[model samples]
Target chain A: MTSALGAGLEPTLDALRARRSGIMCKHWETVEAGLCIGEVAGVDDVVMRADLAHYACRNNRLAQLGLEQDQFAAAVGAATSRYGRRRIGVFLGTSTSGILSSEIAYRQRDPHSGALPASHDYRHTHNSYSVAAFVREYFGLQGPAFVVSTACSSSAKVFGNAWRMIAGGWIDAALVGGVDSLCLTTLYGFRSLQLVSDQPCRPFDAERNGLSIGEAAAFVLLERGDAAAPGNVLLTGVGESSDAYHMSSPHPEGLGAVEAMRAALRMAGLQPEDIDYINLHGTATPSNDAAENRAVMSVFGAATPCSSTKGHTGHTLGAAGAVEAVISALALGNELAPAGVGSTRLDPQFGVHYLFDNRSQPLRHVLSNSFGFGGSNCSLVFSGAAP
Target chain B: MNGVRLYVDGIGLHAPGMAGWSQGCEVLGGRAAFVAEVPPLAAPQALPPTERRRVGLPVRLSMAIGLEAARQAQVDVATLATVFSSTGGDCDNCHHLLDTLASPDRTVSPTRFHNSVHNAPSGYWGIATGCRLPSTTLCAYDATFCAGLTEAVSQVSQTGEACLLLAYDTAYPEPLYALRPIPHAAGIALVLAPKQSERSLARLEIVPDAGLPGRMEDAALEQLRTRVPAARGLPLLQALARQQPAEVVLEYLDAFHLRIGVMPCI
Candidate 1:
């Protein structure tokens, strides 16, 4: 995983343990919005591999960077040797994709005829499928591949898709993840919606206003867990639902969120009390946090320890699901409930147990929540392999 | 690899000269001559007036086909899960946002900003139908239709429930069009079930193959099949129209094609 928190899992764990915030007030590209952003450092300097030059863009660069870290490529190579390349699939998630390339192309359009530059490559860069295509070509895998683009819930939902494909005997394994890069469209677009925070986002804090936009690339290899190791984390359950209420606003009572959580628990054959920690989707927006709190209370109540790591990495948009999933795994492995950075005080109105400080405890099962624009909601359950 | 079997309970289609499933079958079955004229699209009446006015071509196209298939299958739209696939989502809205962002003002409309998401149609579908069921949106460039079919069928096979697959694509406006030239707007919707039912139109066994993909016989239909990503399902639709047991290969990824064995039910 590569995120604003750090480049790899160890560094991300370190930052989470230390409760360090990666968000800073900086201007990205030409836009001077004067807002806080969780920009991944050195993304502009990333160069595409020679063979994959046609897939050059900020999004692919971030994906390549994430793929190179934590010996992920080597792990995939081993999986290839075991399962063969044709038995694995690539399923990724992204929102705006490399629309920045088109945004730039639009600026460089010919004034006379309004023609775009001949060098513009929409298929490789701007297309929503580009990241998956790049990853598939990078690994030379010849299996089913697609990109899910359901806003913030995209990557989380890919887990459900991969699980179904594997369960259905179509593919033996899946490279499931998400990659979203900083683009003027999101930065300015969120700004237009008045959802961009001027300071580091304080998720679940009493004074929280809105979200701090961030960029990240997170990937996880999912295979059948029949022959799993002792300490390996296993994906137990996945639930997906739609709000059917509004486009940008979540359902007031979080009815869909409740349904998704309950469905996930039902699939896992576990009850709400089985969840040890909850990774809240808290984007720091007033309505989002409040709605999620209602959903969490209705399902798990106020007993389970929960925190939104968005305070550490900021909301990575489409990548938030995979990013937080990795974080949840890290927390389970380390048995640490990382603090919700930037949130000094919990909202008094929130009935759920919102963790404001790091707590060390024996953790077994964790639930991560990710909801997005269009009222799409997804919840995932992860548990440590039985000892 | 063994093929996965699924039943097609209903079908919806909208393209140039082919407006609905019956019309599409007529053209594909060779009972009627294929005509190449722009088709009229009406706003989905299920949506309220405010939302109805806000939607663009992609939403209208998806809603038109989705509602048609659901109505034909006699299933509650509120309970059916959906898979929406498109090469580029709302290209016109994207162009508008790009133009606005590039201008001196650099201020985008909130409605346009929200609608720019690839899942806008899926979101609107939920609102219009009041379906809290999960809906996923995906893109695989030109192979989008096949990809969506794969996902929808997999869902039906695994969950033992009906799934709706909606594949559509609209042409980009100007400068962007120069890069990726999708000629006309087209959409196809299939309501797939795990088991045969009273409304089952056909049974399909889908498997990945390396064989050459089937093509439309008519010149105009062939052009549409190649130009528009969603229309690549033309050969499959043609087989369904023939109502005879047949095997049809559809374009998937560069590595392999999807070969489906179609057996008519009625």
Candidate 2:
């Protein structure tokens, strides 16, 4: 996993432990949107592999960087040896994808005929399936592959898609994750919607105004439960739902969010009290946090420890689900609940236990929530193997 | 990981010359001559006036077929999960946004920004039907139709429920068109259920195969099949229209294609 927090899992956990914020105020690209962004460092310097050069773009570069870290590629190699290349699938998520390539290509269009440059490759870069195609080609996998682009819930819902594929005997394993890069479209687009925060976002805080946009590439190798070893984290449940309410705004009462959580619990055959920690999808937007709080309060109440790691990573948009799922896995592996940085005071109306500081505990089960534009919502449950 | 078996309870199709499922069957069944004329797409009645005005061609094309299939299946639209697949979603809107962002004043409209998401049609589907069921939007370039079929059929097989698979693509305008030259707009929707029902049109057994995919006999129809990603399901639909047990392979990822065994129920 790579994000504004750091390049890999260890650095991410270290930053979470230290409560360090990776958001910085700077001008990104040519857009003059003066808002703090959680930009992944050194993305500009990333070069694509020779064979995969055609897939070169900020998004695929980020995905390649993520694949190189934590021996993730090597792990996938080991899985390939066991399951064979054709038995595994690639399911990824991205919002803007490499639209930056198109955005830049548009700037270089021929003034006379409005033709884009010859070097521009929309199929490999700007297409919604670009990242998945890159990853599939990188690993030389020949199984089913596609990209889920339902905004924020994209990556989280990939877990469900992978689960169904595996359950339905389509693939033995899946490389499921998300990669979203910094682009002018999101920067200017969110600003247009008045959902960009000038400072680091304070999720669930009374003064919370909006979200701090971020970019990240996070991946997870999902195999059957029987393949897990002792102490290994297992994806127990995944619930997906739609608001059926609005495009940008979440349901006021979080009706869809509640259904997602409940459905996940039902799938896991566990109750709400069984969950040890909650990774809130707190984008820091006033309405989003409020609606999620209502949903969480109704489901788990105020007893469970919960925090939005977005305070450290910023909302990574489509990648937020996988990023936070990684954080939840880290929490279960290390037996600690990370702090919700940036937010100074919890909102009075929010009745849930919003963690303000890091806490150490023997965590067993954790729930990570991710909701997105177009009223898409998904929740995942991860648990440590029984001792 | 062998394959899955499900029933196609209903089908909806919209493209040049083919207006809906009955019309599509007539052309595919050779009962009617294949015409290569663009058909007018009406705004989905499910959408309110405000949303109807805001949506572009992709949304209209997808919703038009989705509603048609759901209505044909006589299922509750509010609870049926949907899978929307498109190679390029809202291409016109994307071109407009790119044009606006490249201009001197880079003020993107909020509505356009929200609608630019690949799932805009899925989101609007939820609002249109007031269905809180889970809806997934995905893309696989030209392999989108097969990918969506795999996902939707897997969902039905796993949950023992009905799922709607909506595949559609629209042309990109101007300079963008020069890059991705999709000729016309087309969409196909299939309401799949785990078990055969009174409305079952065909039973499909889908497995991955390396065999060559079937193609349209008519040159114009075959051209549509190859040019538009969503129309890749043409051969399979043709088999269903023939009302005979047949095997039809559709293009999928890499070297593998989905070999579907179609057995008509009625």
Candidate 3:
């Protein structure tokens, strides 16, 4: 993992046994609250996914705790009101943004019009920088705004980059998160992979076949140590690894997974068993679950409590890490081992502990893993205390 | 050790100009446009019938080159990580969708939409390859060649096995050509691993180059030509098969030139 790794960097894992407090959390129900878009382009003549996103983005009806994407400035405003407006930077990750817009615009094309619709500007909407621009403009942020496009690791890498930027004195405060609306590209792409289950995926289950596609957008406000160091969840460590393996295949031995996990542990200065709870990248596919199982057993043994929440909202792709990042912070705050929604029974072949159901326990530090295609692996360790 | 390295494990590409890269870098001897023959407004990128065109060429090239590099590494892909870098994304369809939207009545192709995601090819690669290892896609423009190459080398150093680094770029369509301002197209790969003294071909030497950031790219090909004149017409693909590193350089907009040092580990 250090082939191109710079110096003075470390990365790790933690165990979440199970306990209780309330900071905030995001569940499917939260997406139910209608997000009224002032104006939209096409697909309006009839109803479409982008149209109902105001209230139809989530799978379950679990209420999420974060602010709406459109209210990005309000979230920043909320943060600034408490800490006093400081230089703000923006970082976000996404699989597909405004792609729904593109789809809608295309569907409304005029045969002889000789031009596509103007509602969703192809250049602005498809460039991947639109969301970055949206957040920067909304909050009047001038520090730095970058959109990370590293497939699923996009959001986790955001935290990593922001940490470096802040440590390097590039910004005093920043807002980091991700947002990706569901689109046909994702649904069909998963279908092509044959990785998409006919139904919602059952992660870590012996009978588990594939994953369910979902959409989400989330963010978090990060600030450097300042007045009183607001006892908020502290960003602890991040580990990134590249295995140069095949475009789609992972090393059967979990070579890069081990390195990423080890790096995360090194960054946190902790051992494998030190982790309290582990949010796995269990996409429910045969290869992924088995490979991850091997990695966990080799490191933390079979006693660690592990669970995958993919059952709740499906796989959010790039936004998976960001949504799960917020979930980890909330986990530390609430001290509850979220119910592993998909898995019915653990694969007996793997001895590592699998959270069959949700449990409440004392939590400290948790490890969140988000791996992407093209052999990019990223692991994040979050703690309640400052490292 | 702090310097950068680039290698070729395999190759996957579909351009109007050519097929497979072999040793000697001669495979790229006559560079031309793959977009010109694509007709006035061709359909989005096509794939083998079995695979279909569910993925655009931008992504297809990434996966092909990525898989080819892994095959070259002679390692099981189920375990290694991947780093995919590209200058442009599945833009052909993106533009197509835009043109459709520009119509008085926007009617988009669901097929076009599905093939357009940046990760579409990645998802297909994962499902088809069945490796299940984590994958990452990055964008750094022309400099992506360096950023991605260095990143993979870092991964190999960090992991001690190998890393697959795929860099690809596709030109815009006619409409986009009329819009954007650059002539761009390419697909390249490297498998970076720990240097084996006995198998090592060449050692990569990277300095800070504060005064000559872009010099690495400027001097790479020429330096290789000077050192191995016999490779002038040698196909990049054949060279890779014979275990050779094709020297190449790229100049960045910011003058932060990146030289892809292909040291051998045969």
- A150-244: candidate 3 lDDT, tens digit per residue: 66678777776566556544456778876665554555455556676755577888888877665555677777744224347877778876544
Top-scoring candidate (DockQ): 2
What TM-score does the predicted chain A of each candidate obtain versus native chain A?
A: 0.99, 0.99, 0.79
Predicted complex 3: CAPRI docking category:
incorrect
Interface RMSD of each: 0.8, 0.8, 7.0
The TM-score values for the models, in the order shown, are: 0.99, 0.99, 0.60
| Distance from true location, Cα of A39 in model 2, Å | 0.6
Candidate 1 residue-wise lDDT, A1-387, digit = tens: 999987999989999989999998877788866868898998878888999999999999999999999999988888888898888989999998999999999999999999988888999999999999999999989889999999999999999999999998888999999999999899888888988788999998999999999999999999898977988899998999999999999998999999989888888999999998999999999999999999999998889899999988888999999999999999889999887999998899999888878999979899999999999999999999999
Give all candidates' CA lDDT scores. Answer: 0.92, 0.93, 0.55
Candidate 3 error regions (>4 Å) = A1-75, A78-87, A110-114, A225-230, B1-87, B93-169, B174-183, B186-266
Query: What are the per-residue Cα lDDT tens digits for candidate 1 across B81-200?
Result: 999999999999999999988888999999999999999999999999999998999999999999898899889988999999999999999988888899889999999999899999
Query: Candidate 2: where is the Cα deviation over 4 Å?
Result: none
Error of 1 at A132 (Å): 0.3
Worst 10 residues of 3 chain A by lDDT: A1-10
Q: Give the distance in Å from residue A191's predicted Cα in candidate 3 to where it truly belongs.
A: 1.0
Give the local distance difference test score of model 1. 0.92
lDDT tens digits, residue span B1-266, model 2:
46689999889999999999999999999999888888899878888999989999988999899989998999988869999999999999999999988999999999999999999999999999999999999999999999899899889999999999999999999898887899999999999999999999999999988778888889999999999999999998899889999999999886878999999999
